[model samples]
Target: MNNFYKNYKGIIWLLTGILCGSVAGLALGKKIEVLKPIGDIFLNLLFTAVIPLVFFAISSAIAGLEPGKKLSRIMGVMCLVFLGTVIVAACLTMIAVWLFPVHEQLTGAILTEKVNPQPIGNQITALFTTGEFYELLSRKSMLAMIIFSVIIGFAALRSGEKGTAFTRFLHGGNEVFKQVFIIIMKLGPVGLGAYFAYQVGVFGPQLFGAYARSLGLYYATGAFYFVVIFSVYAFIAGGVKGMQKFWRNNIIPSATAVGTCSSIATIPANMDAAKKIGIPDVIANVTIPLGGTLHKDGSSISSIIKMAVVFALFGKSFNSADVVLLALAMTVLVSVVEGGIPNGGYVGELLFIAAYGFPPEALPPAMIIGTLVDPMATLLNSTGDTVAAMMIARFTEGKGWMENGEYGLESGVTE
Candidate 1:
């Protein structure tokens, strides 16, 4: 029990906080409103470290890439994996919407027109541009950041000795941000407790019922998607034995993410597991951290699924163009920016719904519903990260210092 607690202290504390907050909110009655400010402070602290962390981690990972064919292949495979997951997520979302439609009357109070719509052309322009203009448009700016980072990384790789200084600089920055993240996370229990209490106080326990319904749908769809998609990928990558071996080693991290519902917090364990599975340290370090920032398949899936359900509930069917655009936009957003920010899935879902001129009344329930699915999303996403690391290791096996099975191959694949 001591060892277990030592390993899962964060998750245990988070759960304890939530449980206490829920009870307090129920008992405190009107006083529950006081928790809101405290919760906001916690959120702010968590978010404060995100942008710097993302920029530094991504830059370092890209900079570490070898300049030649190996880098190109890794990038290509990463892109393909990201794109494929996005499509699967979008499709699963559409299916969820069709299966369990949200009733319009239930969300009538949430409908409003508070947000001003941005021009599509402007959004597209911001997506491709650089500098202050891009920063101002946070949602679309990720594409620009990704492009810029790639170019800089490639340049760094080509510079040889000159790049060493820059690489060390970025690596130092990453370590600093990670330390800051740890400091913030230490206060997680307090912050999460306050936030959880405030939510219950504001919305009441009745809201949890709605949250549960949407959550059930999200999980059902997600499970189906995982079984069909990841299973196939695992089989192709390593066969039945490989798939089994991978899951056996990774189950702890996956379960930890699900229980904690925070991918960033699960990084330590995930990194450890990746190493145990025979993935090269450099690849594991680069990919897992980058994946936490960039890969958000589960969040994307839930957001789009919730959006479709909300749209169907309001009797507003999206046209083919809107569907195509939404899918494309979601794919890019999920791939580049979604997981990098705190409460990112919630913010992105609301923004996407508002962008399409959907009714505002749907936002609150959608947000609540989304949280219930967060754990599942986190689990799937963490799994995706580990899977990508394994795949990269497989692809780059022969070229690197660590040959096949030398580092403790779990998949029974002989060198």
Candidate 2:
């Protein structure tokens, strides 16, 4: 059993779990609902590491970098690529939703739940404002934590030797968190297996048939973006040959994301792909992790799709301001802390609710959207991370990176 578990791959286990869960769900129906707690435990375990993982991973990466104009340039390019693609994704989602509009009505158990509006100002303030330390632990204020980490990183960079010690401490802590995350992820197949079963039992197979049109449209759009948008990015970064190289190098990361349904889990593969595609270690190390935590084009797009489709289902139209707000929130706000898990998309769903006064009824459909779209979304997100790293390497490292010439990883080095 020890050898078996050791040899067992995570994706295989997850797929096996899904198949078993689906079978159990069909066999037992709602009778197996009692096992949901087990699935919840799995989800909770995955989320448990998220805050610390993000904080340490990003802060330490920033702190380790030598502060200078080159660092600034890379950061600028990375942010631009991440944000630009996310906005494009949101627009594409809106277009897809418009083309394949959903006309779903609230029925069955979905009609029973309603979401009340919360105080939006305080929640919004929590995003950019810093105060109590306790706020760092609150998942709702993840942006605040990210901002705080950035400050710490810069401060440490300026602190000289003292900062080095602190940064090292953070790096050590990050390793610890990574190990914990791996341990928790090992249980994912079992946990998510039960989750799949519960979802299938609760929703039934007809759920897919019911939402087929909208779901089909969402997937087709995903394919379009992956093939077209990524190709454009690759061409711009490394030209035609570069685009071919990127797709050829990216298969592992893409497969890992689709299988695990988590961009975070694809970090190792992303870094390797980046290396194969000639991105420097400095850029890959910093951007890949940071991208995993922040650059969420995939999730942003899915959120837009959900908002547009759900509104259309209820026979409503979003005004111009609402559209602007949706685009900004999904592109800028939710991207910062979008996790790489099954329900990670829920974070954006809340943003939709808060931003647009979407009712709780929005959640049921939103969840269905997540189930259908998350795998492709993760693939997009992970692939985008690699593309950003490549672009940044090209822009910051210039000829060496673009020409696929050999370059040593030197800190604060300039030609």
Candidate 3:
């Protein structure tokens, strides 16, 4: 039995769960109904893991990055790379949304009786206030926790011997949690299968019908982004040879991202790919970690897709101002603060819900789409990080970056 489990891949199990769960739900959900609790158990486990998983992972990644003088320069280049990708991703999403339009049909969509839209001022105020120390304990306040962790990470670096010990402790904690995450993921088949079964039972065949085309477009655009967009960036950074090296080395990282669906979780794989593609540890360690947190073309692209679909469902038409606002939100706000935890879609979904004053009911469909496409989105995001690392290395460290040849440091990279 153990050997059988060992030989089977996790993705296969997850797919099996989806297939079996959907079948069971359609066939036996009303009769049994008891299976709902089983699915809930898995979801609760996932939620339980989110906070500590995010806190330790982000801080540890930050602590493990190169210290002092090199930090700012690396972070700056990475942010630029992340922002550039996000803009391009946002543009692509807008184009896809325009090309494949969703009709105004909310049948079988998750609905709420009434939604009291919060004022923009109130929402902004609440975001910061809700992230206070006490409020940070709440699941909704992950943004605050992220900010706190980054501060603690930088402080750990400056604290001398004690700081080094603290960083090491966080890194150790991160490793332990990764194992825990794996263990939880092992149950994904049972959990996801049950969950999908319940969804199928409740919504029936219409569940797939509602979001199919929108999801199809999103996925098609994502494939194009990976092949065409990434290749273009690679060429700019390292030319033909560099592009070839990037594609060759990217296989593992991209595959891992699809399986894990978490950029933070994919860090180790991304770093490995970076090394294989000849990016130095100095560049990889800093840029990759920062990218896991900040550079999310995948999430940004998904945000636009979600918003477009949700808006269509709500029967809201986009004007020039609405389009501008969406571009700003997707390219900047949502892209930067997207959480690295699995099922972290709600953070961005909340932003989508509040920013456009969409009825809170619209959130479910948006989050549903985000959840469905998470693996593909994460693949693009994580893959882009490694590619960006290589690009930055070549541009900043010169064509000999692969050879570890020293290039001129920017003003703050050295003492």
Candidate 4:
């Protein structure tokens, strides 16, 4: 018990802070809005660190690798696995909305801002490259940042002896930023607690009342996917034993994901969980970091919900075959499109509105529903990365991977 607490105390405190903040918000209402900056401070710290953190993490992982089929195979398998799970997520949500259906009367004033939607080609170009190197320093250009890191990593690896120092530099940088993130996260409880309070205090009524019915559908559906569907993935990864190992190590990551509401922020926790679960560092390092950028089952599920709800709100039938197929396709396309955008939440909303030709008024409720669903959506997106790692390890290392002394359950890690 003491050991469990030692391993998990960070997340415990963070969740407690969120709960307390939520209660305070419910009790104090608008008065608690004053605490918003505290939460913003925490978020800003994370956002500031993320760009460099990702660069080092991915680059160091790649630099440490040798030219082998395993790494390339892992990438191939990871892409396929991510795609498969995302589709499953979208399909499950599709069935749920179809069965119960989401019917919402848009009560809030629609967003009146002028939106000049960009062309898809331009969006994709912007997603992958920046006009200047300085632009990659920003978190908005995460995918571009990742691409550059990979190039540097491979360059370092190919340099043979000369690149060794740079490889060490990448590794040293990775460790430094990780420790920095740990320090920032120590403030998680108070920061997230205050943030939660501000959100509920300021927008709770709109989120809880006006959007409640639709929110309920998403929350309920996300819960099902997070709990039931993910468990099946774990079981498939290692059978019954895989499920036990996964659930046992997943608590901190799961809680952290919900608290942070950012997959990138949750990477460290997921990395630790991957360690205790005995995934090869090669697999964990690549999957968790890459997953934050490339993979998002939660967001995929939300894409379906957003499409359906928007169609329903506009008094259109979303039950047609073509529309459902389009929703699935759009979810995958926008998932890639928004990954590089800063504050990725809004990018997808705008992209979908533009792609489907939804009127500007449709943007408001889509934004609200998307915003409210973010916590769970992030939870799924972040924790699912760790589970995906397990599956990847199983494929790459065989079913006996866990028992091969990589996973020292008593000591957490053999290393």
Candidate 5:
């Protein structure tokens, strides 16, 4: 019995969640609103851990980078891989939106008067009146946190003996947060179940038709983005044989990510696969963790597509400049600036929505549809990470840090 439970824990939890979600949906149909609060509590539990967890994880990761000029190359390669993928993803999503448009006006679309949540008054007050406001915005802020962490970490490296202890402390903190992440992941099934249940309950069957249409388009666009972007990368990096081998080795991580729909939760499995594919320890260690935090191809692409669709459905046409800005902003904000945690999705999506000036009623529908389409997003994300790792591995060959045959264990590297 213990062995069975151990072997089937994830499946069991998933099935349990589906059952709970179904029940919650039915209850909502019957007009039982109490379940909504239960769902909120579950969601709150997920959200509460995000800020601290992201700060610790990213700060430690950046701080721990070997302090030297080599760090620049590492950051450069990472940024290129990230930005390149984002551009490709954005383009593909745009193509998909143009090809298979899914625009349906939502009946009863709740429209609230537009109010600027970020007022000049609040901004000034936050800057001066609150001592920790800057800290909160800087340290806990996703993009700000990454920048601050990298700067402080680099400073520590430059400080010689003076910064050694602090750097070590940060490293220790990173490890602790990793362990905490593992514990949180163990609760994933429960949290996901509650989240799904709440979604179904709150939205009810009335939302089914609209969401189903939107979500289907979302997933379709995501799949197209993955195939187009990753396939090209695979061809350039490894040719047909290399691409085949790469996919063979990474199938597990991709599947797991798709099934779980949480890139952060899939880190352990992704790292394990990276090792098997012969990705250098340093590269994998740096890339996968950083990728989980910042490499959000699926999420970013989906956001663009969803935004385009939403605008069209509302009879709003964005100029080319608007599209360009939205694409660039979504790519940077979603991929690089977002946190690498479970509920990081919510924060990232909200940030994008706000930055794009999307409506509030759109938030709920977007959240629901986005969550439903998460598995597809995760698959693309994991696949993109694997492809980037492979590309970096190929580029780093001949450099003393990495040898040619290292990542070609299964299928030897071809010229």
Candidate 6:
């Protein structure tokens, strides 16, 4: 009982605040506008801190990789498992939207400025690299920021001995910014509570109607993916016995995913679960940490729903081949390199807007979708990491990886 409260402290408060704010909105209606300023203050803080947090978090993880430390066959197969799972997730979402359309024309779509989109070639180039270093500092150029961070990481890695001090600097900045984010998120219950209240008051019942439809769609899809698709993955990874071990040990990580809503937060539990499941220590170490940032089935699923909502509001046909393909590509891009912090999907949401040339107005409402879907998304995202490690173990370590009470034997140490 004490452990449950300790583990779920963040979500319990946040959910309580959200429920209270919803009741206030239902009671007070548009008068909730008075609370908008409270929400905005927290939002401004989050936006300001996110850029540096992303920069250091991404750069430091890559920079500190010490080349051949664990970068072996596990690394190779790990990338494949991540990509395969995200593709499945993306495809699954596309199918869900087709079967159960969440489309509704948002009245605010008319308020958008005329979008004079740049050429595809220019947009693609700008998607990855900012012409000026200063441009990467803003949230709008998130992909560009990520690319810049990656280059910085590789550059630091190539510098070998001389880069040791620089790597330390990145690591220090990463820890500092993580702590900063923790402090900011401590305000999430109040901020998001007010934000939800304002949204329900202004948007009226559409917050429950259109937005709820979107939420329902994502929840249904996520539940299906979690139960059915993940079971398939577990079966594939180790057959019946392997699947049993996974189900047995996955509780702590799954609970952490819902409670904390952060894949990075769930890593220790995930790694411990992997240890208990008898995954090779080498594979667990490489795959679980790598998956925290790189593998996100939930985001891949949610990204599609987000794009679908944006398109529906704008009266665009999401069934188009090219648009669907672009969404799939973006989600794939999003899933592989997503930041694992709470609300980190904000970066990927921006990418969706820019990639499809959606109006800036699309972001706020879509962010609501991200927030609503976060717990379940984090469930799939974090738990999927542990499942992915098992799959990687299957491929790299071969069949007997789970043979002869192997999973019960504790960590199978393999350098």
Best by lDDT: 6
Best candidate according to TM-score: 6
Better of 1 and 6 by lDDT: 6
Summed backbone clashes in each candidate are: 3, 1, 0, 0, 1, 0
Give residue 75's error in model 2 in angstroms: 4.6
Q: Which lDDT values do the candidates have, in the order given?
A: 0.63, 0.69, 0.70, 0.74, 0.61, 0.79
Q: Poorest 10 consecutive residues of model 4 by lDDT?
A: 406-415
As a TM-score, model 6 comes out at 0.82
Local accuracy of candidate 2 as per-residue lDDT tens digits, 305-411: 67765665444564356455645665566666455322346555554554454543444456556655667888888888998787777777765575543453465
User: Model 4 compared with the native: what TM-score?
Assistant: 0.60
The sequence of per-residue lDDT tens digits that candidate 6 reaches over residues 1-415 is 7766786676677777777778888889989989988888877787678778878878887887755455556777888899999999999999999998876535533223444556667767877778788888876677788778888988998998899899999999988987898898788788878877876776665556777788899999999999899889999989988789999998899988887767898999999998888887767777898788888999999999998887776667788766777788889877765564445687677667866766555665676678778889989999999889889878876777765223432433333
- For candidate 5, what is the TM-score? 0.65
Q: Compared with the true structure, what per-residue lDDT tens digits does model 1 show for residues 1-415?
A: 6756665576567667777887888788658978867767765664455556556656776777655434444556666776667676777676665667544333532222443445767656655565674472343344565556667667777778977999888778867876786777677677767766765665566544545566677888788766676666665556675577577777788777866667887788788887776676756766788688777778767876676556544555544564557655755564465565445664465456534555434443454456557667888787777777766666656433123544533433322
Pairs with backbone N, CA or C atoms under 3 Å apart (clashes), candidate 4? none
lDDT of 4: 0.74
Evaluated at residue 406, the lDDT of candidate 5 is: 47
- Cα error, residue 245 of model 5, in Å, equals 5.0
lDDT of 6 at 292: 88
Q: Give residue 307's error in model 3 in angstroms.
A: 5.8
Off by over 4 Å in 4: 1-70, 104-210, 405-415
**Per-residue lDDT of candidate 5, residues 250-271 (tens digit):** 7788877866656776788888
- Which clashing pairs does model 2 show? 115-360
Per-residue lDDT of 182 in model 6? 86
